[model samples]
Target: MAIHRKRFRVEEAIVGEMPSPEMIEEAAPMHSEIMAELRAIRAQMAKGTPPAPLSGSAAMAAIDASTAHELSEARTMLETYRAQIEQCEKLKVELDLIHDAIDRTKREIATLHGKSFDGGEMAKVNGELGAVVGGTEQATQQILEAAESIDQAASAMSKVQSADQQKRLADDIQERVISIFEACNFQDLTGQRISKVMGTMKFIEQHINAMMEIWGGVDAIKAHVPAHVDTRSEDDKLLNGPKLAGDVGHASQDDIDALFD
Candidate 1:
Protein backbone atom coordinates (compact mmCIF):
# COMPACT_ATOMS: atom_id res chain seq x y z
CA MET A 1 0.00 0.00 0.00
CA ALA A 2 2.86 2.46 0.81
CA ILE A 3 4.45 1.80 -2.58
CA HIS A 4 1.26 2.00 -4.85
CA ARG A 5 -1.13 4.67 -3.09
CA LYS A 6 -2.24 7.79 -5.25
CA ARG A 7 -3.31 11.13 -3.46
CA PHE A 8 -6.55 12.91 -4.98
CA ARG A 9 -6.86 16.73 -4.38
CA VAL A 10 -10.48 18.25 -4.20
CA GLU A 11 -10.85 21.94 -5.27
CA GLU A 12 -13.35 24.29 -3.38
CA ALA A 13 -15.78 26.47 -5.58
CA ILE A 14 -15.36 30.32 -5.09
CA VAL A 15 -18.58 32.38 -4.38
CA GLY A 16 -19.22 36.14 -5.15
CA GLU A 17 -19.07 38.35 -1.99
CA MET A 18 -22.14 40.43 -0.92
CA PRO A 19 -21.82 44.12 0.05
CA SER A 20 -21.36 44.97 3.77
CA PRO A 21 -24.29 46.37 5.88
CA GLU A 22 -22.42 49.69 6.51
CA MET A 23 -21.91 50.24 2.78
CA ILE A 24 -25.62 49.51 2.05
CA GLU A 25 -26.66 51.93 4.88
CA GLU A 26 -24.39 54.68 3.43
CA ALA A 27 -25.89 54.32 -0.13
CA ALA A 28 -29.56 54.11 1.09
CA PRO A 29 -29.89 57.79 2.24
CA MET A 30 -28.47 59.18 -1.06
CA HIS A 31 -30.85 56.98 -3.16
CA SER A 32 -33.96 57.89 -1.05
CA GLU A 33 -33.14 61.64 -1.04
CA ILE A 34 -32.79 61.64 -4.87
CA MET A 35 -36.07 59.69 -5.32
CA ALA A 36 -37.91 62.02 -2.88
CA GLU A 37 -36.73 65.18 -4.67
CA LEU A 38 -37.73 63.71 -8.08
CA ARG A 39 -41.23 62.83 -6.74
CA ALA A 40 -41.64 66.35 -5.27
CA ILE A 41 -40.70 67.96 -8.62
CA ARG A 42 -43.11 65.67 -10.52
CA ALA A 43 -45.94 66.49 -8.10
CA GLN A 44 -45.28 70.24 -8.42
CA MET A 45 -45.28 69.97 -12.26
CA ALA A 46 -48.52 67.89 -12.22
CA LYS A 47 -50.20 70.48 -9.98
CA GLY A 48 -49.15 73.29 -12.36
CA THR A 49 -47.29 75.10 -9.59
CA PRO A 50 -44.56 77.45 -10.79
CA PRO A 51 -41.01 76.44 -9.83
CA ALA A 52 -39.30 78.45 -7.05
CA PRO A 53 -37.73 81.43 -8.80
CA LEU A 54 -33.91 81.64 -8.62
CA SER A 55 -31.70 84.71 -8.93
CA GLY A 56 -31.10 85.37 -12.69
CA SER A 57 -33.34 82.34 -13.51
CA ALA A 58 -36.22 84.64 -14.53
CA ALA A 59 -33.92 86.51 -16.96
CA MET A 60 -32.63 83.20 -18.32
CA ALA A 61 -36.19 81.94 -18.90
CA ALA A 62 -37.10 85.19 -20.65
CA ILE A 63 -33.99 84.88 -22.80
CA ASP A 64 -34.98 81.30 -23.73
CA ALA A 65 -38.47 82.48 -24.68
CA SER A 66 -36.98 85.30 -26.75
CA THR A 67 -34.64 82.82 -28.48
CA ALA A 68 -37.63 80.58 -29.32
CA HIS A 69 -39.49 83.58 -30.79
CA GLU A 70 -36.43 84.58 -32.81
CA LEU A 71 -36.08 81.02 -34.14
CA SER A 72 -39.75 81.05 -35.23
CA GLU A 73 -39.24 84.40 -36.97
CA ALA A 74 -36.12 83.08 -38.72
CA ARG A 75 -38.07 80.03 -39.97
CA THR A 76 -40.81 82.31 -41.34
CA MET A 77 -38.20 84.52 -43.04
CA LEU A 78 -36.59 81.43 -44.66
CA GLU A 79 -39.99 80.35 -46.03
CA THR A 80 -40.59 83.82 -47.50
CA TYR A 81 -37.13 83.79 -49.06
CA ARG A 82 -37.85 80.43 -50.70
CA ALA A 83 -41.16 81.75 -52.09
CA GLN A 84 -39.41 84.83 -53.55
CA ILE A 85 -36.77 82.62 -55.21
CA GLU A 86 -39.54 80.48 -56.77
CA GLN A 87 -41.32 83.59 -58.10
CA CYS A 88 -38.07 84.91 -59.61
CA GLU A 89 -37.45 81.53 -61.29
CA LYS A 90 -40.94 81.65 -62.84
CA LEU A 91 -40.38 85.22 -64.10
CA LYS A 92 -37.04 84.21 -65.65
CA VAL A 93 -38.76 81.36 -67.55
CA GLU A 94 -41.41 83.77 -68.85
CA LEU A 95 -38.79 86.35 -69.89
CA ASP A 96 -36.84 83.69 -71.82
CA LEU A 97 -40.06 82.64 -73.58
CA ILE A 98 -40.77 86.24 -74.67
CA HIS A 99 -37.21 86.67 -75.97
CA ASP A 100 -37.48 83.40 -77.94
CA ALA A 101 -40.79 84.56 -79.48
CA ILE A 102 -39.31 87.89 -80.60
CA ASP A 103 -36.29 86.11 -82.14
CA ARG A 104 -38.56 83.69 -84.04
CA THR A 105 -40.73 86.53 -85.35
CA LYS A 106 -37.64 88.39 -86.57
CA ARG A 107 -36.32 85.26 -88.30
CA GLU A 108 -39.64 84.69 -90.08
CA ILE A 109 -39.71 88.29 -91.27
CA ALA A 110 -36.13 87.96 -92.59
CA THR A 111 -36.94 84.74 -94.47
CA LEU A 112 -40.00 86.29 -96.15
CA HIS A 113 -38.02 89.36 -97.22
CA GLY A 114 -35.11 87.27 -98.65
CA LYS A 115 -37.27 85.21 -101.07
CA SER A 116 -36.19 85.24 -104.79
CA PHE A 117 -37.95 84.36 -108.12
CA ASP A 118 -35.32 81.77 -109.25
CA GLY A 119 -36.58 78.14 -108.81
CA GLY A 120 -33.64 77.03 -106.69
CA GLU A 121 -33.64 80.27 -104.69
CA MET A 122 -37.41 80.04 -104.22
CA ALA A 123 -37.20 76.41 -103.00
CA LYS A 124 -34.44 77.22 -100.49
CA VAL A 125 -36.23 80.35 -99.35
CA ASN A 126 -39.52 78.49 -99.01
CA GLY A 127 -37.94 75.81 -96.83
CA GLU A 128 -36.35 78.49 -94.64
CA LEU A 129 -39.64 80.37 -94.54
CA GLY A 130 -41.50 77.20 -93.46
CA ALA A 131 -39.03 76.60 -90.66
CA VAL A 132 -39.24 80.24 -89.60
CA VAL A 133 -43.04 80.17 -89.59
CA GLY A 134 -43.10 76.94 -87.59
CA GLY A 135 -40.69 78.40 -85.05
CA THR A 136 -42.71 81.63 -84.91
CA GLU A 137 -45.97 79.78 -84.27
CA GLN A 138 -44.44 77.73 -81.44
CA ALA A 139 -42.77 80.83 -79.99
CA THR A 140 -46.00 82.84 -80.27
CA GLN A 141 -47.82 80.28 -78.13
CA GLN A 142 -45.03 80.47 -75.51
CA ILE A 143 -45.07 84.31 -75.62
CA LEU A 144 -48.80 84.33 -75.03
CA GLU A 145 -48.24 82.23 -71.90
CA ALA A 146 -45.50 84.62 -70.77
CA ALA A 147 -47.78 87.61 -71.37
CA GLU A 148 -50.44 85.99 -69.20
CA SER A 149 -47.88 85.48 -66.44
CA ILE A 150 -46.79 89.12 -66.72
CA ASP A 151 -50.40 90.26 -66.48
CA GLN A 152 -50.98 88.11 -63.41
CA ALA A 153 -47.79 89.37 -61.67
CA ALA A 154 -48.66 92.96 -62.56
CA SER A 155 -52.16 92.56 -61.21
CA ALA A 156 -50.85 91.03 -58.02
CA MET A 157 -48.37 93.86 -57.55
CA SER A 158 -51.09 96.46 -58.18
CA LYS A 159 -53.25 94.86 -55.48
CA VAL A 160 -50.47 95.46 -52.93
CA GLN A 161 -51.94 98.98 -52.51
CA SER A 162 -48.47 100.46 -52.05
CA ALA A 163 -47.17 103.40 -54.08
CA ASP A 164 -43.67 101.85 -54.23
CA GLN A 165 -45.10 98.59 -55.63
CA GLN A 166 -47.13 100.40 -58.31
CA LYS A 167 -44.14 102.51 -59.35
CA ARG A 168 -41.89 99.43 -59.52
CA LEU A 169 -44.42 97.55 -61.65
CA ALA A 170 -44.80 100.52 -64.01
CA ASP A 171 -41.03 100.84 -64.35
CA ASP A 172 -40.66 97.11 -65.06
CA ILE A 173 -43.37 97.23 -67.73
CA GLN A 174 -41.84 100.31 -69.39
CA GLU A 175 -38.39 98.71 -69.44
CA ARG A 176 -39.78 95.51 -70.98
CA VAL A 177 -41.69 97.52 -73.66
CA ILE A 178 -38.59 99.55 -74.52
CA SER A 179 -36.53 96.37 -74.89
CA ILE A 180 -39.15 94.91 -77.23
CA PHE A 181 -39.13 98.07 -79.34
CA GLU A 182 -35.33 98.07 -79.58
CA ALA A 183 -35.35 94.38 -80.63
CA CYS A 184 -37.99 95.08 -83.30
CA ASN A 185 -35.73 97.63 -85.02
CA PHE A 186 -34.46 95.79 -88.14
CA GLN A 187 -30.71 96.19 -88.63
CA ASP A 188 -30.75 93.45 -91.30
CA LEU A 189 -33.37 95.34 -93.32
CA THR A 190 -31.29 98.19 -94.73
CA GLY A 191 -31.94 100.63 -97.64
CA GLN A 192 -35.49 100.48 -99.01
CA ARG A 193 -36.59 97.48 -96.99
CA ILE A 194 -35.54 99.09 -93.69
CA SER A 195 -37.18 102.38 -94.62
CA LYS A 196 -40.42 100.59 -95.50
CA VAL A 197 -40.55 98.48 -92.31
CA MET A 198 -39.67 101.53 -90.22
CA GLY A 199 -42.38 103.54 -91.94
CA THR A 200 -44.88 100.69 -91.39
CA MET A 201 -43.95 100.36 -87.71
CA LYS A 202 -44.16 104.12 -87.23
CA PHE A 203 -47.54 104.19 -88.86
CA ILE A 204 -48.73 101.32 -86.69
CA GLU A 205 -47.29 102.99 -83.60
CA GLN A 206 -49.01 106.28 -84.39
CA HIS A 207 -52.34 104.56 -84.97
CA ILE A 208 -52.00 102.58 -81.77
CA ASN A 209 -51.05 105.73 -79.83
CA ALA A 210 -54.02 107.57 -81.27
CA MET A 211 -56.30 104.68 -80.33
CA MET A 212 -54.87 104.74 -76.81
CA GLU A 213 -55.44 108.46 -76.52
CA ILE A 214 -58.99 108.29 -77.83
CA TRP A 215 -60.08 105.11 -76.00
CA GLY A 216 -58.10 105.63 -72.79
CA GLY A 217 -55.45 102.97 -73.40
CA VAL A 218 -55.44 99.28 -74.45
CA ASP A 219 -57.58 98.07 -71.56
CA ALA A 220 -60.48 100.31 -72.51
CA ILE A 221 -60.30 99.32 -76.18
CA LYS A 222 -60.12 95.62 -75.32
CA ALA A 223 -63.08 96.03 -72.96
CA HIS A 224 -65.16 97.75 -75.68
CA VAL A 225 -64.40 95.08 -78.30
CA PRO A 226 -66.71 92.04 -78.57
CA ALA A 227 -65.22 88.78 -77.24
CA HIS A 228 -65.65 87.10 -80.66
CA VAL A 229 -64.00 89.93 -82.68
CA ASP A 230 -61.15 88.84 -84.98
CA THR A 231 -58.63 91.74 -84.90
CA ARG A 232 -55.84 89.81 -86.73
CA SER A 233 -57.34 90.48 -90.18
CA GLU A 234 -57.11 94.25 -89.70
CA ASP A 235 -53.60 93.92 -88.30
CA ASP A 236 -52.48 91.75 -91.26
CA LYS A 237 -53.90 94.21 -93.77
CA LEU A 238 -52.00 97.05 -92.14
CA LEU A 239 -48.73 95.03 -92.04
CA ASN A 240 -48.83 93.63 -95.61
CA GLY A 241 -49.29 96.89 -97.60
CA PRO A 242 -45.89 98.51 -96.93
CA LYS A 243 -44.05 95.17 -97.00
CA LEU A 244 -45.43 94.22 -100.45
CA ALA A 245 -44.79 97.66 -101.97
CA GLY A 246 -41.22 97.76 -100.64
CA ASP A 247 -40.41 94.25 -101.92
CA VAL A 248 -41.82 94.99 -105.44
CA GLY A 249 -40.08 98.32 -105.69
CA HIS A 250 -36.73 96.78 -104.61
CA ALA A 251 -36.83 94.13 -107.47
CA SER A 252 -33.87 94.32 -109.93
CA GLN A 253 -34.99 95.49 -113.44
CA ASP A 254 -31.92 93.81 -115.08
CA ASP A 255 -32.81 90.44 -113.53
CA ILE A 256 -36.39 90.78 -114.74
CA ASP A 257 -35.17 91.50 -118.32
CA ALA A 258 -32.80 88.51 -118.29
CA LEU A 259 -35.69 86.15 -117.36
CA PHE A 260 -37.98 87.64 -120.07
CA ASP A 261 -35.21 87.66 -122.79
Candidate 2:
Protein backbone atom coordinates (compact mmCIF):
# COMPACT_ATOMS: atom_id res chain seq x y z
CA MET A 1 0.00 0.00 0.00
CA ALA A 2 1.18 3.55 -0.90
CA ILE A 3 1.01 6.46 1.61
CA HIS A 4 0.14 10.01 0.47
CA ARG A 5 2.60 12.77 1.49
CA LYS A 6 1.61 16.53 1.92
CA ARG A 7 3.88 19.55 2.28
CA PHE A 8 2.86 22.97 3.81
CA ARG A 9 4.73 26.24 4.77
CA VAL A 10 4.04 27.27 8.38
CA GLU A 11 4.36 30.87 9.61
CA GLU A 12 6.75 31.37 12.56
CA ALA A 13 5.07 32.71 15.69
CA ILE A 14 6.66 34.07 18.89
CA VAL A 15 5.33 31.72 21.56
CA GLY A 16 7.93 32.48 24.23
CA GLU A 17 11.19 34.32 24.65
CA MET A 18 14.49 32.37 24.77
CA PRO A 19 16.14 31.93 28.12
CA SER A 20 18.67 34.62 29.10
CA PRO A 21 22.31 33.99 28.10
CA GLU A 22 23.27 33.74 31.80
CA MET A 23 20.63 31.00 32.38
CA ILE A 24 21.82 29.14 29.26
CA GLU A 25 25.41 29.31 30.44
CA GLU A 26 24.44 28.04 33.89
CA ALA A 27 22.37 25.13 32.48
CA ALA A 28 24.92 24.19 29.80
CA PRO A 29 27.41 22.74 32.23
CA MET A 30 24.66 21.01 34.23
CA HIS A 31 23.18 19.30 31.10
CA SER A 32 26.44 18.64 29.23
CA GLU A 33 26.53 14.96 30.10
CA ILE A 34 22.81 14.53 29.29
CA MET A 35 23.32 16.31 25.98
CA ALA A 36 26.21 14.00 25.10
CA GLU A 37 24.10 10.89 25.80
CA LEU A 38 21.16 12.34 23.79
CA ARG A 39 23.45 12.98 20.84
CA ALA A 40 24.69 9.39 20.93
CA ILE A 41 21.08 8.12 20.99
CA ARG A 42 20.20 10.34 18.04
CA ALA A 43 23.16 9.02 16.05
CA GLN A 44 22.14 5.42 16.74
CA MET A 45 18.54 6.17 15.71
CA ALA A 46 19.77 7.73 12.47
CA LYS A 47 21.72 4.57 11.63
CA GLY A 48 18.80 2.19 12.33
CA THR A 49 16.00 1.31 9.83
CA PRO A 50 12.86 3.43 10.17
CA PRO A 51 9.59 1.87 11.28
CA ALA A 52 6.51 1.72 8.92
CA PRO A 53 3.68 4.20 9.48
CA LEU A 54 1.01 2.81 11.80
CA SER A 55 -2.79 3.25 12.11
CA GLY A 56 -4.05 5.37 15.01
CA SER A 57 -4.73 2.42 17.37
CA ALA A 58 -1.47 0.62 16.42
CA ALA A 59 0.56 3.82 16.92
CA MET A 60 -1.02 4.33 20.34
CA ALA A 61 -0.24 0.71 21.27
CA ALA A 62 3.34 1.07 20.04
CA ILE A 63 3.72 4.26 22.05
CA ASP A 64 2.42 2.50 25.14
CA ALA A 65 4.86 -0.41 24.68
CA SER A 66 7.82 1.96 24.19
CA THR A 67 6.77 3.90 27.25
CA ALA A 68 6.49 0.69 29.30
CA HIS A 69 9.94 -0.49 28.16
CA GLU A 70 11.51 2.86 28.99
CA LEU A 71 9.74 2.87 32.36
CA SER A 72 11.08 -0.63 33.10
CA GLU A 73 14.63 0.43 32.24
CA ALA A 74 14.28 3.58 34.32
CA ARG A 75 12.96 1.53 37.23
CA THR A 76 15.86 -0.90 36.93
CA MET A 77 18.38 1.97 36.86
CA LEU A 78 16.71 3.60 39.87
CA GLU A 79 16.85 0.30 41.76
CA THR A 80 20.57 -0.08 40.92
CA TYR A 81 21.27 3.49 42.03
CA ARG A 82 19.36 2.87 45.27
CA ALA A 83 21.42 -0.27 45.97
CA GLN A 84 24.63 1.67 45.29
CA ILE A 85 23.51 4.49 47.60
CA GLU A 86 22.72 2.03 50.39
CA GLN A 87 26.13 0.40 49.96
CA CYS A 88 27.82 3.79 50.06
CA GLU A 89 25.93 4.64 53.27
CA LYS A 90 27.03 1.38 54.89
CA LEU A 91 30.65 2.01 53.87
CA LYS A 92 30.48 5.53 55.31
CA VAL A 93 29.23 4.20 58.63
CA GLU A 94 32.10 1.70 58.74
CA LEU A 95 34.59 4.47 57.94
CA ASP A 96 33.15 6.62 60.73
CA LEU A 97 33.60 3.78 63.21
CA ILE A 98 37.20 3.29 62.07
CA HIS A 99 37.87 7.03 62.35
CA ASP A 100 36.45 7.06 65.88
CA ALA A 101 38.64 4.13 66.84
CA ILE A 102 41.75 5.81 65.48
CA ASP A 103 40.95 9.05 67.33
CA ARG A 104 40.45 7.17 70.58
CA THR A 105 43.69 5.25 70.15
CA LYS A 106 45.58 8.44 69.33
CA ARG A 107 44.19 10.13 72.46
CA GLU A 108 45.10 7.18 74.64
CA ILE A 109 48.65 7.07 73.25
CA ALA A 110 49.11 10.83 73.79
CA THR A 111 47.90 10.50 77.34
CA LEU A 112 50.24 7.60 77.95
CA HIS A 113 53.13 9.60 76.56
CA GLY A 114 52.31 12.56 78.76
CA LYS A 115 51.95 10.51 81.91
CA SER A 116 54.76 8.00 81.52
CA PHE A 117 57.38 9.82 79.46
CA ASP A 118 56.74 13.55 79.74
CA GLY A 119 55.72 13.43 83.41
CA GLY A 120 58.96 11.68 84.40
CA GLU A 121 57.22 8.67 85.88
CA MET A 122 59.45 6.36 83.85
CA ALA A 123 62.50 8.30 84.96
CA LYS A 124 61.41 7.92 88.54
CA VAL A 125 60.98 4.18 87.98
CA ASN A 126 64.44 3.91 86.46
CA GLY A 127 65.98 5.89 89.31
CA GLU A 128 64.29 3.73 91.90
CA LEU A 129 65.38 0.51 90.14
CA GLY A 130 68.93 1.76 89.81
CA ALA A 131 69.09 2.56 93.50
CA VAL A 132 67.78 -0.90 94.35
CA VAL A 133 70.50 -2.48 92.21
CA GLY A 134 73.24 -0.33 93.67
CA GLY A 135 72.10 -1.01 97.22
CA THR A 136 71.82 -4.74 96.51
CA GLU A 137 75.35 -4.82 95.09
CA GLN A 138 76.81 -2.96 98.05
CA ALA A 139 74.94 -5.16 100.52
CA THR A 140 76.08 -8.34 98.73
CA GLN A 141 79.67 -7.20 98.84
CA GLN A 142 79.45 -6.42 102.57
CA ILE A 143 77.80 -9.78 103.31
CA LEU A 144 80.48 -11.63 101.31
CA GLU A 145 83.27 -9.86 103.19
CA ALA A 146 81.65 -10.63 106.56
CA ALA A 147 81.17 -14.31 105.55
CA GLU A 148 84.86 -14.58 104.58
CA SER A 149 85.92 -13.13 107.93
CA ILE A 150 83.66 -15.51 109.88
CA ASP A 151 84.93 -18.49 107.86
CA GLN A 152 88.57 -17.48 108.61
CA ALA A 153 87.90 -17.03 112.33
CA ALA A 154 86.14 -20.38 112.61
CA SER A 155 88.98 -22.11 110.79
CA ALA A 156 91.52 -20.49 113.10
CA MET A 157 89.52 -21.49 116.17
CA SER A 158 89.51 -25.14 115.02
CA LYS A 159 93.30 -25.00 114.91
CA VAL A 160 93.87 -22.99 118.14
CA GLN A 161 94.83 -24.90 121.30
CA SER A 162 94.97 -21.91 123.71
CA ALA A 163 91.80 -20.74 125.44
CA ASP A 164 92.68 -17.02 124.96
CA GLN A 165 93.15 -17.42 121.18
CA GLN A 166 89.86 -19.36 120.83
CA LYS A 167 88.00 -16.72 122.80
CA ARG A 168 89.46 -13.95 120.62
CA LEU A 169 88.40 -15.89 117.46
CA ALA A 170 84.83 -16.24 118.80
CA ASP A 171 84.65 -12.50 119.49
CA ASP A 172 85.79 -11.77 115.89
CA ILE A 173 83.13 -14.20 114.56
CA GLN A 174 80.40 -12.40 116.53
CA GLU A 175 81.40 -9.02 115.11
CA ARG A 176 81.35 -10.45 111.55
CA VAL A 177 77.87 -11.94 112.15
CA ILE A 178 76.64 -8.50 113.30
CA SER A 179 77.95 -6.98 110.05
CA ILE A 180 76.14 -9.65 108.02
CA PHE A 181 72.87 -8.85 109.83
CA GLU A 182 73.29 -5.15 109.06
CA ALA A 183 73.92 -5.86 105.36
CA CYS A 184 70.56 -7.70 105.18
CA ASN A 185 68.75 -4.33 105.68
CA PHE A 186 69.04 -3.70 101.91
CA GLN A 187 66.18 -6.18 101.35
CA ASP A 188 63.70 -3.86 103.12
CA LEU A 189 64.87 -0.85 101.09
CA THR A 190 64.72 -2.82 97.88
CA GLY A 191 61.15 -3.86 98.57
CA GLN A 192 60.07 -0.24 99.08
CA ARG A 193 61.74 0.95 95.86
CA ILE A 194 60.29 -1.97 93.89
CA SER A 195 56.83 -1.13 95.17
CA LYS A 196 57.13 2.40 93.82
CA VAL A 197 58.23 1.09 90.44
CA MET A 198 55.35 -1.39 90.37
CA GLY A 199 52.86 1.43 90.98
CA THR A 200 54.15 3.40 88.03
CA MET A 201 54.16 0.32 85.80
CA LYS A 202 50.56 -0.42 86.78
CA PHE A 203 49.52 3.08 85.75
CA ILE A 204 51.11 2.67 82.32
CA GLU A 205 49.57 -0.76 81.90
CA GLN A 206 46.10 0.62 82.60
CA HIS A 207 46.41 3.10 79.74
CA ILE A 208 47.71 0.44 77.38
CA ASN A 209 44.82 -1.86 78.27
CA ALA A 210 42.36 0.96 77.66
CA MET A 211 43.74 1.41 74.15
CA MET A 212 43.51 -2.33 73.54
CA GLU A 213 39.86 -2.20 74.58
CA ILE A 214 39.20 0.61 72.13
CA TRP A 215 40.33 -1.55 69.21
CA GLY A 216 39.00 -4.86 70.50
CA GLY A 217 40.78 -6.64 73.37
CA VAL A 218 43.78 -8.84 74.22
CA ASP A 219 42.84 -11.36 71.53
CA ALA A 220 42.75 -8.62 68.92
CA ILE A 221 46.09 -7.30 70.10
CA LYS A 222 47.59 -10.78 70.02
CA ALA A 223 46.72 -11.06 66.34
CA HIS A 224 48.90 -8.04 65.58
CA VAL A 225 51.81 -9.07 67.81
CA PRO A 226 54.93 -9.80 65.76
CA ALA A 227 56.68 -13.13 65.93
CA HIS A 228 59.10 -13.35 68.85
CA VAL A 229 62.78 -13.48 68.04
CA ASP A 230 65.52 -13.98 70.63
CA THR A 231 67.85 -11.30 69.35
CA ARG A 232 70.24 -11.53 72.31
CA SER A 233 73.63 -13.21 71.97
CA GLU A 234 73.86 -16.67 73.56
CA ASP A 235 75.46 -15.32 76.75
CA ASP A 236 72.95 -12.46 77.00
CA LYS A 237 70.10 -14.90 76.39
CA LEU A 238 71.20 -17.00 79.37
CA LEU A 239 71.32 -13.87 81.51
CA ASN A 240 67.57 -13.75 82.09
CA GLY A 241 68.23 -12.27 85.53
CA PRO A 242 66.57 -13.47 88.72
CA LYS A 243 63.11 -14.91 88.20
CA LEU A 244 60.17 -13.18 89.86
CA ALA A 245 58.52 -14.87 92.82
CA GLY A 246 55.91 -17.51 91.82
CA ASP A 247 57.22 -17.51 88.23
CA VAL A 248 57.40 -20.98 86.74
CA GLY A 249 59.24 -22.50 83.73
CA HIS A 250 62.60 -21.00 84.82
CA ALA A 251 65.42 -23.25 86.02
CA SER A 252 66.04 -23.08 89.77
CA GLN A 253 69.51 -22.71 91.35
CA ASP A 254 69.42 -26.40 92.24
CA ASP A 255 68.62 -27.32 88.64
CA ILE A 256 71.59 -25.28 87.46
CA ASP A 257 73.94 -26.84 90.02
CA ALA A 258 72.75 -30.33 89.12
CA LEU A 259 73.90 -29.70 85.52
CA PHE A 260 77.54 -29.57 86.65
CA ASP A 261 77.14 -32.56 88.96
The most accurate candidate by TM-score is: 2
What C-alpha lDDT do the candidate models reach, one value each? Answer: 0.63, 0.88
Q: What ranges in model 1 sit over 4 Å off?
A: 1-54, 116-261
Alpha-carbon error at 178 in model 2, in Å? 2.7
Instruction: Write one digit per residue (lDDT tens) for candidate 1, span 5-58.
Output: 332333112323544456677799999999999999999899998966766988
| TM-score, structure 2 vs. true | 0.68
Please give the clash total of every predicted structure, in order: 0, 0
- Model 1, backbone clash pairs (residues 3+ apart or across chains), number: 0
In terms of lDDT, the poorest run of 10 residues in model 2 is 4-13
Model 1 Cα RMSD, 1 decimal: 34.4
Q: Write the per-residue lDDT of candidate 2 for residues 171-204, one digit (tens) a residue.
A: 9999999999999999999999999988878888
- Model 1 / residue 180 / CA error / Å: 60
- Candidate 1 C-alpha error for residue 236, in Å: 22
